[model samples]
Target: MPVYKDKNGTWYVMTRCDDWQGQRKQKCKRGFKTKREAQDWECRFLLQQGGDLDMLFKDFYKLYEQDMKARLKQNTWEHKACVIKSKILPYFGEKSMKDIQARDVLTWQNELLRHRDKHGKPYSETYLKNLHNQLSCIFNHAVRYYDLSTNPTAKAGSIGVKNAKEMNFWTKDEYMQFSEVMMDKPISFYAFEMLYWCGIRLGELLALTTADFDFKNRKLRINKSYQRLKGQDVITEPKTKKSNRTIEMPDFLCEEMQEYFSMLYDQKPDERIFPISKSYLHHEMDRGVKATGLKRIRIHDLRHSHVSLLIELSFSAVAIADRVGHESIEITYRYAHLFPSKQAEMANRLGELKKGGGF
Candidate 1:
C-alpha cells in the first residue's frame, strides 16, 4: 500500500495487483480528500485483488451489477439497478462485506418499515420484499464466488412478501360499460378491446406492427415487446419463451383493428400501430374511469380481467394459460379462487357412474 499527497494537497493511492497473466501491475487512483480516504481505498483495492470477502460492499456490488447487466433485458436490468442504487447502496456503500452482521440487516429493515412516502404510506410489502431480495443477492454472490462464512440476510430473515395479497379485475359487464364510452376515441377503444379480448400484455400490444396481423387468416402474432427507457422507445423480445405466440383474433376485433389501421396515414409495416406513449394510455384510462364511475384498476388488471372472463366461460386452466402465454401452473395458482370449485360436480358425476355400473 502506497498513500501519497499530490501537489494540489489532495491524496492518492498506488496499489499493486496481479493481472490475468499472473504478472504484478501497479494501479493508481486519485482525488481522495484525506490521507485516511486514500488508505481505505488502497485497503479495499488490495482486499478485492486478494479475492476474499474483506472488500467493501459497494465495491462487490459493482461486480455483481456488471454480471447482471449483461444477463438481463435492458428494461428489466434498469429497474433492478435503480432499486439497488437508490435503496441498498446508501446504508451499505461504505460498510465492509466481512463486517456486516444479521443485526445490522435487521436495523436497516426496520428503518425501511418506518419510512413513509409522499402519500404517507409505508412502502408496499412487494416493494419491501424486492429490496431485501436485491440486498440478499449481493451477499449470495459473495458466498458463491468469494470466501464468505454465511449470508447475514439469511439469518436476518426477509421482510415483506413475494406477492401482494389483493388481486383486482373487472367483470365482463363492467368492461362493456367502460368500453362503450371508450369508443369515442378509436385508439383507446381498440387498445382496451385488444387487451380485454386478446389477453395480451401491454408491452406486447404496443410492439405490434402491421405485419404481425394476418387479416386473411384472422390471426395476430406476438413475438416482441415494447419498452420506453430513458426517453427512448425500445423493442425487445417478449417476456418469456412462451410469450412468442399466435392468437386467433375475434372477427369483431379484426374489423375494429382494420378500421383503426385505416385511420393511420402511410404507416410502414414495421412501425408500431400504437405509437403513443404509455402516459397517453394512462390519461385515457383516467378519463374513462372518471366518466364511467367504475372502480379503478390498473392497465395490467385488463389482463386479469381477461383471465376472469375465460374462467367464467368455462375454459380449462391449460386452455386459458395457452391463450394468455402464461405457464398453466401460474394460471391455476394465481387465479385459483376465481376458478369454480368442482366438488359437487365431481360427486354427481361419480354417482352417475355408479348407477351405470361402469367401473
Candidate 2:
C-alpha cells in the first residue's frame, strides 16, 4: 500500500513511522526500478518500524556504528568501520540480518584469504584475523541487541591461517652493524637507539615529548601514542593499561639524550621529540639497510631485537614483560625460543641431580 510510481519511471515506498519517543515521522525510500522491489522494501521497512527482525545489514551497521562510537576508542572504531565499509558491507549490505548464514560467512572468508593487495601480496594472517574479529563483533552486537537469531560469524571458524614465515629479529652484533649506518643521521641514530633500548612501539616513540623524558632521573614515561588515520595525525592513549609505564634509560643513553635536547634550542615541552612522519622514518631505515648491507627488517623488529637481548641477558619473563609494557608474561612467551639456552641449562642441572641421587 506504501508503494508508488514516480514521474521519472522509478518506484518508491513512502510510509509514516513512530520515532524512539513515539512521535510520528515520515519515511521515504526511492529509486527502485520495479513495483515488486518497492513493495518488498516497504514490507521490510514496515516490519522494522514495528520492531520486527527485518533490517538490511547496511542499515544495521549504522546502528552498530552509533553503539560503537561511545564504547570504543576513536581509532578502534575507525578500523572496524573501515573493515565494514571495505569488506563486510560490500558483501552483506543488502542482505537481511536473518538471511545471512554460516555458509555465506565461510565462503566470504575464503575469498578474503584468496584475495591479494594492490602490490600482489596476500593479506597478512594478523590482518585477516582482525577483519574476522570485526565481522564477529558486528554480528554479536546484532544478536544481543537486535534479537537476531544467530551470529553467522560464530560458526564461520577461524579466518586467518598462522603465518608460515619465521619471525625476524636482529642479534646485538647485527644491531651494532646497523647502528654504524645510523651514526651519520643523528635523528635516526637516536630514534633506533631508543627503539632498541627502550622496547617501545613506534607510535609511542613518535608521540614522545620533552615532558615525557626525566633526564635527571634517567627515566622515560610512556602514556600516549601517535596514529595516522584518514590522512590526519591523532594522539591517543596507550594501547593497554600496562602500556602506560615508565622505563629507565642507561646512563650512556641518558647522556646522549641530554646532548640531543640541548641541540633543540627554545623547544616547548609539548612538542614531539621526533616530529617527522612514519614514511620519512621508513625511508631513512631503508637507506640505513642499504648502507649497512644488513638483512632487511621492519622498524617493528627493533622491539623484537630488544626482547631477544633481554632474554639473552637472563632476564625473567615477568621483568621483561613489565619493561616492554606487555600486558602479561604469557604475551612475552612468544620469545621463549630465544631463551633455549636457559632450558638446556635447566636440563643439565636436572641431570646432575639425577647423578647425585637427589629427589
TM-score of each predicted structure versus truth: 0.92, 0.86
Model 2: per-residue Cα lDDT over 167-251, one tens digit each: 6888989998888888887788888889988899999999999999998898999999998988888999998888999999999
Candidate 1 segments whose C-alpha is farther than 4 A from its true place: 16-26, 349-359
Model 2's alpha-carbon lDDT is 0.85
Model 2: residues >4 Å from true position, as ranges? 1-52, 117-120, 161-165, 341-359
| lDDT of residue 137 for candidate 1 | 85
Task: Go through the candidates in order and give the clash count of each.
Answer: 0, 0
Report the number of the highest-lDDT candidate: 1
True-vs-predicted CA distance for residue 13, candidate 2, Å: 7.8
Candidate 1 lDDT: 0.91
Looking at model 1, residue 276 earns an lDDT score of 78
Which residue pairs come into collision in candidate 2?
Answer: none
